[model samples]
Target: MPETVFEVDVDAAPEEQPDPIVNRWHPDVPPVERVSPGEKFRVECLDWTGNQVNNDDSASDIRDMRLDPNHHLSGPIAVDGAKPGDLLVVDILDLGPFPDNEWGFTGIFELDNGGGFLTDHFPNARKAIWDFDGVYTSSRHVPDVRFAGLSHPGILGTAPSHDLLERWNERERDLIERGPDDETAVNHETHDDDPPLALPPEPNEVLLGDMDDEAVEEAAEKAARTIPPRENAGNCDIKNLSRGSRVYLPVFVEGANLVTGDLHFSQGDGEITFCGAIEMAGYVDLKVDVIENGMERFGVDHAIFKPGNVEPQFSEYVVFEGYSVDEDGTQHYKNANVGMRRACLDAIDYLTNFGYTPEQAYIILSTVPVESRIAGIVDLPNTCVTVSVPEAVFDFDVDPDSLAEISSEGRGRAARPS
Candidate 1:
């Protein structure tokens, strides 16, 4: 018998729902429920796109989708005994697809508006409908490839303290003020293209009773958008954080207002492209416990989590290599954004060899699970990145047996070193 303390329903009507789905994580956002430490609870999360998208949505729909308040998060569940400088231990006990219908989607954004890795190669928008059957998911758009589900919450963290929020705002504002000309400014823009700047809270919106109008306004303006991961671990999108994983987060505000959303049925490392992984609406069971003064004991400030029971499938890979150094001898290795783009283009080129057009290849890459790795970074002038696509993902024969093994010996034989 689990000591369940709170429950949230993502599909409920606005008036009927117990907890409000917030677009941002702020300490001022009133918690939907309160629970003592060591209590268990369940959260029902809407898809990353906030249920605005559906299986019937077309590529055009994705292209025209609004970017504000992108991921709808489910909580800020206050822990009774938690406080700043403490640690919150979230034990992920179970994660599964929606009970009514087990379905999800993978999407690729248009290149003009903050595109993904292969933006130049794949400028158009696309989508793949996924059907989750137990532990596996298959997409109708990309047939013959079924991947094991590694469901996990894409966004999970505690609300930042007033000071931390100010620091984040200052740092990001500085980068934005630096303009896009600076090499470091390319992917450092803090907020998404269109933030809900003018959108005020709904009339029925619930807020913390203790806050006044000035405090509410401050919170609304200063709340960090859920785009990038921070010290508190919001929007980390680590796919391995599935059932059985234990996540430790540094507490910032009183009661450690924990929030969670952006459930993904599956995702590859780096989530290379935009619009993100197999976005899904699902139920997550978590056991919340507090570790008093654990941050000082552990000597860490950021979030850390152990891998879940789910393991990535190992198969023969058709590897593609990319370099950050261009023909002009200019190096862009300092920023990973450049390396990701190069690797994506390399992957697109390789996919074209197998009878896939640039568009089709890009869609396949976005929908499929392809591992991206930083192969090397120490080699001064140039940094190396590699994208590994499993040979097993293709139903047709790619002749993996004829390809060189992914080892030094295979490369040595090809070079014929005496």
Candidate 2:
């Protein structure tokens, strides 16, 4: 085990931690600790919502989730000799869940609150609890399926420079002001684009680590929200950032104030349901190094990474396909979002044949090791998207044609909105 430089209690609130856990991004957020080059260490993180959610069978916790103070990151761990224009090389040595707490959750927020990619279709809040058994995880709420998790940090990045931060705030605030357009907001009445087009640097509910009281308000006012993925790679949710992965993060400020948290036990390609991944509090082991002037040498403007090879391997799959058309039959010109949502919905419909309800199928698609891809990008009017779910995950043969009825049974329905 590597030295744990940052640790937080899973049951306690992030603000009550011994070491500060921040949720915003800025150069002056204050580094919790410092590490030398080539040194390996461990970072323990609070769950994305700071454990406001419970392990029980109720979607109420998800329905009332707070997004402002979300994604409580572990640090601004300054690396010695790291400078601007350099690339911070972070090697993800290993990732593991807490021994005492071997369970995690996957949530689908209501349309009014934590809106997701398929918010229009599945508007109500729902949850699935998955218990970890070594590499494999099984959910009691939606039963008869088991698969290995590809553990990874959902949010991780270096701090932004003043200019970069300002640029971010300016553009994002503009988007918020402009609001969602007709295309994105396909439904204007019941299913609104409720979460807003962008989250700006608001002073309300922001945390800036161990900074003094006098500077808290000022710093919080300018700090960027940790929801969207930008040039620095905060909240990309790329599922590929697992153990043994090598991430090259662009450094804007000195020491490359690397802050990371929002760990996930497993996730599908899209994480389509917002808060959909098997959310958990876990520790990540990492080794840090720096590449002098590597950003310019590689012409890198944003964070780039090489994925790990430790993900679970499945031999066969049941592939579903969709086109760039809305559920209402509205045609869009090569829209990937619409296409992916269609693919996911199609899969969900097929899953219902196996005794899973629409909600259970949605949860299964969100938590499993499903693969999503854009099979055709150049085709006009409709871009074909494919979602391939591994057949081995199911106990029974997933041959839709062969099995005409419910061949499997769920433990119980996932918690629904009350």
Which has the greatest lDDT?
2
Candidate 2: which stretches are off by over 4 Å? 181-193, 405-418
Q: Which residue pairs in model 1 clash with each other?
A: none
Candidate 2 per-residue lDDT, tens place, 145-186, comes to 898988899998999999999999999888877766655544
Question: lDDT by residue for model 1 over 226-261, one digit each (tens)?
Answer: 777888899998878988999999999998988888
Q: Candidate 2 — number of clashing residue pairs?
A: 0
Model 2 C-alpha lDDT versus the unseen true structure: 0.86
Query: Residue 86 error for model 2, in Å?
Result: 0.5
Global lDDT of each candidate:
0.70, 0.86
